[model samples]
Target: MRYPSKSALLFIAAGALSTGASAHMGTDLHSHGSFMTGLLHPLGGLDHLLAMLAVGVWSAVSARRAGPALLWGPLAFANMLVLGALLGLRGMGGAVVEPMVAASVLALGLLVLTRQGMNAAASMVLVGGFAVFHGLAHGAELAATGDAVAPVAGMFVTTIALHLSGVALGWSLRAANVWATRATGAAVATSGLALLMQLA
Candidate 1:
């Protein structure tokens, strides 16, 4: 039996997803710190979404030979995000916080762009570090709330969804154009660079 083309599948996947988050730094979304906010957090921001997508896709691409990164990679990220939120709640993240956040996106995008074969364990560690900054961003926002349970729950759910979507995209793109995916990585990396420049 013949299967549908990979590009066609990707097109369908892309069209199925949408988000309404903004990318403006210093934007405070701590209106109530509800679960819905946390769940929608990652889904709202373009940069954060790109980073998560890159992580999932990169993990998938690298894991093709070994197995599937559909679980461990995101687990590492989710765990580290909890730790990062703790740091933010404790007021531990210093001035370098925002830069690190941008760096996380840039680094993840580069990973996807390179498509260098990395063991799943190593990839988890790298993406775990990136997840910390991402968590810090969210935690810093909810620092005043003092309750991470609902928000974290929301965030974890949204993040996992994004990761899954990325996994699908990576798998589909594999049968499509590797260069096109790489081009996506390049664009994401460039956005991170532009953000960093703005920060500086």
Candidate 2:
């Protein structure tokens, strides 16, 4: 299994630093950078990051028209997440949301790594369904922060970029070797476990 090349790790590190810098400069959920913070919130956590990337990697492993669907799946998730936040904002639902999101991560990662011969369409439907949990989490956080549109927009774009980057890397690795893909799936599942632990 290829660990993230030093360069890739370094790149992620740099991106994290950039987000931290932006966040500290008043982009937290409370203030000026609320929107930006909302976008970065997903990447800011390990569970969400790995689960989202795993979605793409798992999608590519299946035998369908994987590329466009893989990209669209996460985007759809983010969109729905915003809608969920709106729901939360209106005081409709609360609690257990993050746990469900983490559970989706665990389930999807396990599916991608262990299940074989499942149809590609099935995988798409499964992952897309899980994405709603993720989207709601994003939306709920954004709604709570009450940041203006611009900051949230900034955060949204940055996060989508991270998801796409994960998808691209996952696809590239899958092209290189099947084991690499399996290894990624395992790592992603492990991350889901970690998220569950935190919640517990």
- Candidate number with greatest lDDT: 1
What overall lDDT goes with each candidate model?
A: 0.70, 0.57
Instruction: Assess candidate 1 and give its TM-score to the true structure.
Output: 0.83
For model 1, what is the alpha-carbon lDDT of residue 24? Answer: 39
lDDT (10s digit) by residue, model 2, range 63-154: 35554566655566556555555555555445677777778767766755663535545655566567666656655555655554654465
lDDT of 1 at 65: 56
Q: Per-residue lDDT for 1-200 in model 1, tens only?
A: 33545643453243222122235333465567778878777765566777777777777665655364456887788788878876776777877877887777778768777876666688778889888988887777777776778888888888888887787776765666767667656666776766677678
**What's the distance in Å from true for residue 58, model 2?**
1.8
TM-score of each: 0.83, 0.71
The pairs that clash in candidate 1 are 21-44, 39-154
Q: Give the number of the best model, judged by TM-score.
A: 1
How much is 119 displaced in model 1, in angstroms? 1.3
